[model samples]
Target: MEIVFTVLILLLAVAASGVAARLAPFKLPLPLFQIGLGAVLALPLFGLRISFDPELFLLLFIPPLLFSDGWRIPKREFFRLSKPILALALGLVLFTVVGVGYFIHWMIPVISLPAAFALAAVLSPTDAVAVSSIVGKGRLPTTLQHVLEGEALMNDASGLVAFKFAIGAVLSGTFSLMDASLSFVLIAIGGIVVGLAVAWSFGLVRRKIIEWAGDEPGVQVVLLLLIPFAAYIFAEHFGLSGILSAVAAGMLMPYVETAGAESAATRMQGRSILMMLEFVFNGMSFLLLGLQLPGIVGLAHIDAQMAGNVPVWHLFAYIAAITAALIAMRFFWVWFNLRLKSFSSALRGRRSKQRALDVRLISITSLSGVRGAITLAAVMSIPLAMPNGSAFPARDLLIFLATGVILCSLLSGSFFLPWLLKGLQLDGEHQRQRAEEMRARARVSEAAVRGIENAHDKLSTQLDEADQALLTEVSGSLLATYRMRMDAESDSEETHRVANRFKQFERELRLEALRAERQELHRLRAQQEINDETFMSLINQIDMAETWLLGSLSSSN
Candidate 1:
């Protein structure tokens, strides 16, 4: 019962935090609001405390979020930016682990090199979710945003794998560079393979089931929700990277959707469910970090004692040093990587127009490397005792430092990112994307118009004169709509504006009619003029129509 209450409270807190974020006077990130609420909940007055279980937390929250990111990320952009993403995710993670590991060891001699490496490894993975929350969607330049998203997706696995190796080294008193490298390759590849296989198998099964039992949205949604968890578990069972498996499953999901095997209802419902889950889970993750902060802080004295009876402020200084070191390392790497890319391009006789180095972009990238829940989870998972039963060295101090770093990073990003991003121009990228979109929309509308005309011509011969007239009229209406869309995508700004205005008027009129229809249905139900089932069916039809109207309106704008 207590456990149940705790879960309920956390869910309520997640909900409240979201509302609070929106209602706050100043515009702050949602994660910051959630973390603040969580911290308040941990106060002595509330007496709310939950034990942090790293394994369970990862299993419960990480997979679906990663999967959703993988599923929705712009695949074209991800592939195009793959070089930079790999450099940051794979190369930077290794660099951070080594660089920060030695820095941590040198700064604080109490923490063993292996344990310090473990800390740095966990810190290497940046939380793109946190970054996204800090900077709203579509605010960052599209290319940079895609690179960051891709980096976040891949680095979670790489960072955690490194952390695993470090922890093993600490426990077993053994280190093997050659074996670990081979294992890393195998683990990463194996996870990707397992994810692809699982996703493909699931897609096949889903198709067969739909054929057998028909497309039921409820059942389809439930099955969709299971894929990430299944991928993670299956990969882990084979000693692979579950994080990558989940991401792989997500990335494969879009292809499954492209099959167009399910009804529109299934797609809509699945999207809604996934969106809600992402919000709630993401909020809970930051909230959990906040809740743990007080308890972690309470142990500062003990950590101070463990660090040779040093003052607690020294721990904070260590955190500041580590955080600064990370940002510096990221800035240096981004600068060097860009410079190297430019040099390679020059050697290859490619004249890139963009500057070789953009300081603003580099600063944004550096600050965007904010750590969040994953670091907390990974550091907390450090084993309490070694194989010989001795306590893990500086365990409390390690957790303290990790928790501090997470807070510091989040704060730093919140404070400085907006300032760095101000007046930054990515107008060229935006204009290119807008032009490409207009072309694509125009092409699609043309195809739709053609399809409708072909269908009408084929059916006209089978119909009598009156029926043929009816078919022609219906087809003409759809063709007009498609033609209007094409007109809206015209190169002429004036022509596009006229078409868009007509679309807006049409949408508004349709929505008004839908609302009236809904009201009539409700009136009939209240007066007992219609049966409940009939009223419900009619209302659902009206609601779906309204939903489509509003969705189209928003998309068009």
Candidate 2:
């Protein structure tokens, strides 16, 4: 019953979040709003107490999210930006663990060094889910978005590995720089090796399944869903990074090949499922974080009696200091990288304009380091007691401080991002992309017309007069429509206006045609001439046609 209730609450939160994002008068990032709603619902009078075992949450939520992200991320872009991504994901993460770790220890004398390092590791990785929600589509430069997302994907593994080592240090009451450094390299490399091996095997099986069940989209989506969990479990079983395993599995899948060949229904259904998964996982994670606030605050004071001479406000002050240090270090690192980028680009004889763009992107990337679910999960997973049974040093305070950083990062990132975007005027880049798209579509249409002409010639001898007339009319209409879109750029203003008028007339005709086709499908189903599955398939094609026509009309304007 508790499980059911928890699920119900999460579903409700997800629904509310969707509705709010669509209906709200003012712009509020969905994650931030969900967090606020959850915080409000956590009031004592609301009687909505929520608790999550950090380990369970981490295992359940992180895998699919990471896998989905990896699957969708463009492989070309990811590789091209690999250098900057490594800088942020691995280099910056390690730097933060040391820089912020020492800062936290300085601020809170009671917190041991290992514990401080643990906190730093927990807070180092930025949550891509949170960042994505905060920066919706078309808000950031594409390059910047890709870099941030790439950073988000890789940093989780690095941060968590550092976290494990820090925890090991705390539990064993010893630390060796040489051993830790060697161990870090081994674990990082080993995890990647395990991830790649497991994911490659899974991909082979998945490809076979896709071949066998190619027509069954529902079955295919279910199989795809399982890959992430399977990859995570296998990697973790081998004492490797489950997060990297899931990411690797997603990346290895036949993203490019299958995408072109999949049926429209399959593609749409798969996308819908992944989108819903993201919405639920991200929304619930933030909501749960908000609900945990009161409990977390209470836990922060759990050792109040033992915490002599330390006040709650003082702890908050320490949290503030640590959060500042984290943000400050990111700025410094980003600035340093930008300088290096500028120097390298100069040596290569790149333009000053490119250097300026780099500065803008790195600035946004630096600000986008908002720690989220993974951080919260890692901190909350800290053991309540050491091996000797003494209370884990400053566990509660660490949670509190981590929460402080999460809030600060989210608020600051979401608030200023839009303003920064406005200043950059990145819409020209979007326009350039649209223009390129038009060129590509025109080329495709030209090839399609050539194919039509060939088919007409080949079929003329086989078809009767009526069939020939139908083919001529249909193919002529297609050729005309494509030619108009193809000429949209080079045409004069008056010519474009005439073309748009034709486009509008064509749109109405196409929509009417689609309506007739749908009615025919429904009629066929009702008459028992076609099964429900066949009717649905026909209707889906019609729906897609209608959608494309409508979308094309909108894009033209």
Candidate 3:
């Protein structure tokens, strides 16, 4: 208990550094850096170690991360990519177990294939938290991002389901086709039913509590925090998937409805509550990734040494092979499913751009298979001894391999992803430029609306009262949109539509003026008319305006 609390303190320090760095110029990837930091602390001299109980993690950490991710994912996008997400989450996991398990068992005659299946099951889930939290800042296609998000969400439940069956097989020293299939079906159905029931129950309780508290912010936030865990415990107590129950409750939790006409203050308050929860969980997860190193070494050293010359080098190699199969299998499945989506979209003339976009995105997601706390937890929860007083084979090897995969993936994905962003011509500079252009064009709309208002005001004596009221509402909304544009704050979906209409017209009018200003500035620079700083600053102004204009036009719909 002392050690757990101490390790948490260190994790807090690491998270603080990460959160601070996010606001600083010294940008670094979260997974690679934090995990590396923890690994550095794991050396003999540092003597930092952490012991995580399986149920403790499931109870404490899983709820917020699952809820936050589920809540933030745009509902429209989640639904749109549901097909591919479901495939990766469910179909791909089963495929991996069958494929990877068969190969591992065949390669090592002594080990039962069901044992290999257990290894396979552990590696089947993708850690979107690691991947997204690390490098999600980079330029990527929306279609690809949503797909990756969806895959991570559903894959947890699928992998956990398979894991249970494998564990059951090991316990009984027998595997049953009918029972495994039925168990999975029951887990899924039972989880969803339990999750919804709990969501409703907790929501009712929260509503009553809020009325009692009379809108106390602290009470509201506390109630929100309790719902995910409440829902999870309710499901798992009934023998359903606790993780899925968390995800389901989160998905059902108030997004827009709870914050009707969501005020900025209220949204920020809610987001901060979630962000804090995510921060603590994420920090602990990365630390857990590294802290298990010594325990794993102790766990696997004997088996690894004995199996070094064998077809498998121990449990590590077993897990390594399964991880490879799980990752490799994704490429084929993603490409195949995407092509099918493409064909349907092509028939309707709707799918071409996004299909091309997703190809590159899936490649990135393939590298983002960084096993984090969930995978570590699953492996850690592997039964310590079999029913007949025999130890589980390769338990140590499983931990070692899981750690290796996590490291290699964190490094490779974080470094290579930025390069992919460049190759794909998706970068922050483009996003910033585009944002500026949209705001510039929005300014033009505001100017036009102002002119209309002035004319209407001057002619008010000639107009009807209803006409004046309609004009006043429309004009005020337009001006409100303009104000938001100036600050680069997000506007309502309706304001976005109006802003987009004026973009092209503004571009045509201002393009020439901007060009002429550039020519004069160039001439001045050519004649040593301005210093490099001033000339560049002047040039940047025009470029920023143009980008905002273009972005405003494209994103309007």
Candidate 4:
């Protein structure tokens, strides 16, 4: 009951689930595992009752999560997959909402058309987190992966807007196709403009701060964290889609430098922080859902009679029907799109390997649409009462239905995706991609070696012969290490043999350097040349340098 205690317990649960996931003998999707943990924690013996404030959840979680995802996505790949992304995120979402809305209204007459549409919209956007957790580790075509990710990023905005309009129709008891369409366009455009403006302003300020601060990695990453929340809040304040604002803000970040020490540290630290946040937030989200399961189920049973005499079994049936419809409609839409593309290619008198890839991509994409947190948030955000303060028609049933669909979609996707992957023989171009990576690594190594040589040349002019020889020896060893990596392949025994020797030598040199640095810093402190604060700071820097060096050596090996 105590807030602090409750928060601690939830965090502990998240930590335990994470550890369990890592230690499990077989692969288990994290969301499923976390949700299951929550369900078990909800038992009477645990005395745990988890409740989520849907608005708070959306505001606190969605922006940062979306922004991090957006920042990670390559602009080039996003554009490359734009056509399919649009087809799914925009086109398929619209189709699903309208088509499924009508079907739900017809199938369950107790639910109003607007309410049915709201339900449809809530279920429309596939959670990228869910899809990635389920399918990211498995071998799938990279293009398909990109399309799925891109679609998920964009569709949250589109789906939430559709949900808003549908809720508007329900409350106002009026619907205008043309006005709704116009409003949708305006909201999307305005959200994008606002997001860009906010991000641009923040980026300018960030650059100024970095210029003034002289590239503090900690400060840089802190600033990066604030951009998404600012964009989300600003967009929401203006009655636009905050989700899109966050996405846009993330995508708008300037070209990131990867070569410098400070830049590398910033990138590494930022990635790690984001990943930790993602793990905690995603795990907590599912756990919260599981916590609410008993309550929602209980409510469903209590309100079953009120919901047009629909029994629990009927709710289960509705879930099955809607999920089936969701999957089937996606397949149909994808099939239609592929057919159109093939037709156009034929008319143009062109044939290529991409046609075959398209077939496989269609299958993968159709199956990748697993609903998760966003869907639950939207459904739960619906008000229980209308303007007149009477019960919103079938609100409980709608929640039940949405929750069921989420479970159904997640379960089905997780079960079928692996099997489908096993059946398909994919030419993922593994060899080609590896070769490209090797070439890129080689270029980077050459640049590093050149920089080291220039440093050696400068040092030679300043130091004695013995020191100069030591510098030359160090440079040569480093160069030899990179050269070894350049020609090494993980699969080759000869390469491994050479790599092992180089790695051992490199590790020894690095450890000695680390020891010398520590000794010098401590000696300064002992001689009262540096204060305690300065000594600790220098020691921390040494630690970071040693860690980075070790990491580099390990990766090269």
The local distance difference test score of model 3 is 0.71
Instruction: List residue ranges in candidate 1 displaced over 4 A.
Output: none
Ranking of candidates on lDDT, top first: 1, 4, 2, 3
For candidate 3, lDDT tens digit of each residue in 1-557?
Answer: 88777856676667765875577575556755566666667778777766668778778888778877777776776897787778878888888778877876786555577877887787777877677766665456556677778888888888888987898888897888897788888888888777777777766765666566555556567777887888788888889887888887777776423534333345456778898878778776777666666556565656556455443344655655555665677667777777887788889977466526456667776776666677777877888888888987766655566566666566667666666666675535456556776677667757876786787687676779998788778777776655555433346777555544554455667877888988999999999969999999889777767666665555653
Which candidate would rank higher by lDDT, 3 or 4? Answer: 4
Kindly report which residue pairs in candidate 2 clash with one another.
none
**Model 4, stretches more than 4 Å misplaced?**
24-27, 136-138, 214-218, 254-265, 357-361, 429-432, 458-471, 489-557
Clashing residue pairs for model 4: none
TM-score of 4: 0.87
Against the true structure, candidate 3 reaches a TM-score of 0.72
Please, what is the whole-model Cα lDDT of each candidate in the order they appear?
Answer: 0.91, 0.79, 0.71, 0.83
RMSD of 1: 1.6
State in Å the error of residue 201, model 2. Answer: 3.9
Question: CA lDDT of 59 in candidate 4?
Answer: 87
Query: Model 1, 1-557: lDDT tens per residue?
Result: 99999889989999998889888899788888988889999999998989889999999999999999999898988998899999999999999999999999998998889999999999999999899888887778888888999999999999999999999999988999999999999999999999999898889889998999999999889999999999999999999999999999999988875289899889989999999999899989989989998998999999999888999998899899999999999999999988887888889999866675778899999999999878888998999998889999999999999989998998899999988888888746777887887799899999999899899989998999999999989998999999999999997899899999989999989999988888888899999999999997888778888998988777666
Clashes per candidate, residues 3 or more apart or on different chains: 0, 0, 7, 0
Q: List clashing residue pairs in candidate 1.
A: none
**Total clashing pairs in model 4:** 0
lDDT of 4 by residue, 1-557 (tens): 48788889889999998889789897767788888888888888897975678999998888888888888886887997799899999999999999999999998888899999999999998977787777655377666677788998999999999999999999989999999899888888888887788788877776677667677788878877888888998888989889999988878865432224346668778878888887788888888888878778878775567557877788788889999999989988999988788878888998733545355556667778999889988899999799999988888888888988988898888888877777665555545565677678778877887888899888899999899889889999887877776655445788768876776786788889899999999899999999999998889788888888787675554
Give each prediction's root-mean-square deviation over alpha carbons: 1.6, 3.5, 11.0, 4.3
Candidate that beats the other on lDDT, 2 or 4, i.e. the better one:
4
